[model samples]
Target: MNLAESLGDCEFQSVNTAYDENMPVDRKVLVDNATLSGVERLIGESRVRNLGNVDNDILCLEKLLTAILFSDALMAIDDYKEEYRSKRSRQFSFIKFLKLDHVSYADLSGKAADFARSMTFSFDGSKPAGDVVSFFEALRIDPQLRWDVFVSSEYLTMSLLVRDTRDVGYENSIDGVFRNESANADVVLAGIKFDAPVSMEHHAEISSIKDLVDAFASNNPNFRGSSSGSLLARCIFGYGWAAERSYFYNAVAAQNNASVFLAPLRDAFCEGCCRLESRSQVESLLAALKSKSQATMAKIVESSGQAKFALKLPFFSAYLISICDNPRQCIEHALELRNRSEFRDCRSILHNLDFLSVGERSAELNRILGLLEQSCDSLLRKYGVATANGLQVSLSLGLAGISAGTSIKLDRLFPFYRNRPFSRLFRNIAQDMVNVERLGGLYEKLCASVKEHQDAGYPSRTSVTPKFMERRENEYGRPAKL
Candidate 1:
């Protein structure tokens, strides 16, 4: 049948040929041409267009064909037949064509047919070349692509490069795609190289900080005991959950020298404290504190407390509670002591914890709090804090009490001191009482500072309101006194 007649029903109809013994036809050529024609027709129907750039089109088409063939081969694999059947069905409309340079349609179709034939025949148990085998094997084993047929265009392009090239290591492949100048520095540093085309859904999943950490931890083998681990440490230290970063650093430190992370840890701690506008940020600072030595924690606290924009008292309380031998026990002991005196000062600490509790209780906030709580619990247990029954005490109460006490002390001693340095304020609070120490030396300093500040005839910075209209008038030639 003619091409039009063969495809008249919108399905691939078998072409029948009449053969003459006297004049033998090249049946293979005819069949190939017929298949090419069918593909062209489909491409046309799908509205696949190419730009007028031949070189770019050729390159893109080669990658697209390779990806399509690889997907088909994977579906044909006996081991994954059942698993991929539904996936294949779902991917019927998944192949999207970006505008490629205009190349000869015949040349592109011929190349695609050749690729399809090569891929189809290669599944006969014959060992392929090392590069091709590794290229396919890496993709074949990717758990992320197992149940999805959707492949990212970039991944396909990378796969084609790997298949054609030799000596392309994982890092090299990653570097080639995500170059140093690329905006996705986090992905590169975290070693998140995609061997296979992952679905957009999976791409979105790994885009998150938490998932990125998990991916970094689970996927990159080169990160373990390698200098790359430190690079990853630096990268993660800039973004995501501080606790996760600390945990990763601790793990890397375990393998490498702990001293390696000390400098970075100090820097990260100070930077983290400066940006502590949320409970999660506070929790991250606490995690950093928990990971380091008592001396390191003290140094960080002291240095940060001396800054003009010192850590908030409530957050500082959380930090102190985190560093204590047993935060829960410390609070319980303090509460017991308070009870004996018939005076309850733990209210401020509780109030502080309540303030630190997630403001909106959103899912993301809940997740952050959950991770922070777990990290805090682990830190508390590390300090030998357990219940009488040998179970671990929940840190919720300890954290609350610490926060409350810190807030109360700040309110009482440094009521007018907006920038109440954590170090200064914390020192004036009795460790045993978990409340303000009226006789402490720091208390006298705070009293004098408050009195001096009051006498300076300066308005409270909080109470100062900008005169917008007056400023506008001054800017545009001040209005007459009238």
Candidate 2:
């Protein structure tokens, strides 16, 4: 069904921001033909309208247009399947910022279908290739900081470009898109605010989006060692938990590295990916791994009868290196892991495990910790990453919880990300992230006070002030001098 049709019969429920003067009107955006088509038309006319008027404002508009398109594409995909949305949120912590949880699954499905259809109807098979300013025009939006939403539209469009389109202009248009983005560097950076305590611009290694994109795109073997290290740091500093990110990164590294650091680790991870029986088992595995006890591990696995997917290696290493100091336990654990996988390099990971001196093992553990520490340092210097929690909450750095202990539970986090990765009708998370970063300790103090009040038998109070005067009141609580 079309957007109008889908929205006409919408059964979704949401907190209305229209009456909240403090909230911008854009936060209450509705995905109807008028709104979507207006943006489409705006982008369409920008090329001709901005022929000779190339300026900072116009460039910012172009980036904003791209951001809008990118966010739309992401939202469309979230609508298509719940998994994609959850995976991205877990990876990027986008849900914390975007508030995808408030939306209904049914609403997502309908809107996703409309976005898919619109892509087909609007641009056709050809790229919307135009001049320098073809993608945007100089116009201040109600909420200017919602540029992250705008950029998300690009990924959906890019996926189509990569998969569906065979147009001759695709390559040229894609190049043009990047070129324009590069030209509008100020505009792009403006949209992405890094307000963490550290300075990202000062870091030489990963100072910009170009750097991140380049690392993700690199193919050189020489770069693998450094690139993997950087990626690992990004995952840790940017995200909250280490389960899925560890699995993804380890799998990627195993594909390239011939030398296996730990035997049965990769195999166990792979097996877990293929054979895991239930979410409960996954939860058990997370708890057992965190416990870092051999007996605990065996008991959990045996009781659950779960597959090897539940035995992730990085978690094992984290404990083995950090907390667990028993040689006998380490040997027993390695033997248990060995009993499952037949990888020839398993010996490399497990052989002579029982014989190593404490100093040697400690040295190895120290090395691992050093790598992690270096990575964390890099993120702080390069991306302004604060604590893993701060990054997750403030920057949407993908801090998905593996267990219920840290971050959000996988079950809840996943579904929200899957269905509503980006929202057209919710609060702007990007703005929120900035405020959280800017406020820092003050933000935490404010939250604590609010919680304290709630716990002390305070109930919600309805506003007595007029809607139009609320913004002014918030800014001016004092009596007027006049």
Estimate, for each residue in 53-92, the C-alpha lDDT of model 2 and write its tens digit.
1121222222222222222111111221343334433432
Model 2, stretches more than 4 Å misplaced? 1-373, 383-482
Model 1: per-residue Cα lDDT over 1-482, one tens digit each: 32223234332122111111133211100001111111222222212222111111111222222222112111111111344334433432332212212343333333323322222111111122211232232222110110001122101001112222233232232221112112222321222221111112223454332443354335533223212211222222222222222222222322221111111112232233223223344345444533443311211212122211111122122222333332223223333332221111112211122233222223322222232333233333333322222321111101111111233212321222233211111110011112111113322221221112122331111101122322222221221110
Candidates in order, TM-scores: namely 0.16, 0.17
In model 1, the runs with Cα more than 4 Å from the true position are 1-231, 234-239, 243-335, 338-343, 349-482
Model 2 per-residue lDDT at 415: 31
Q: Any idea what lDDT model 1 has? A: 0.22
- In model 1, the number of clashes is 8
RMSD of each: 35.7, 28.6
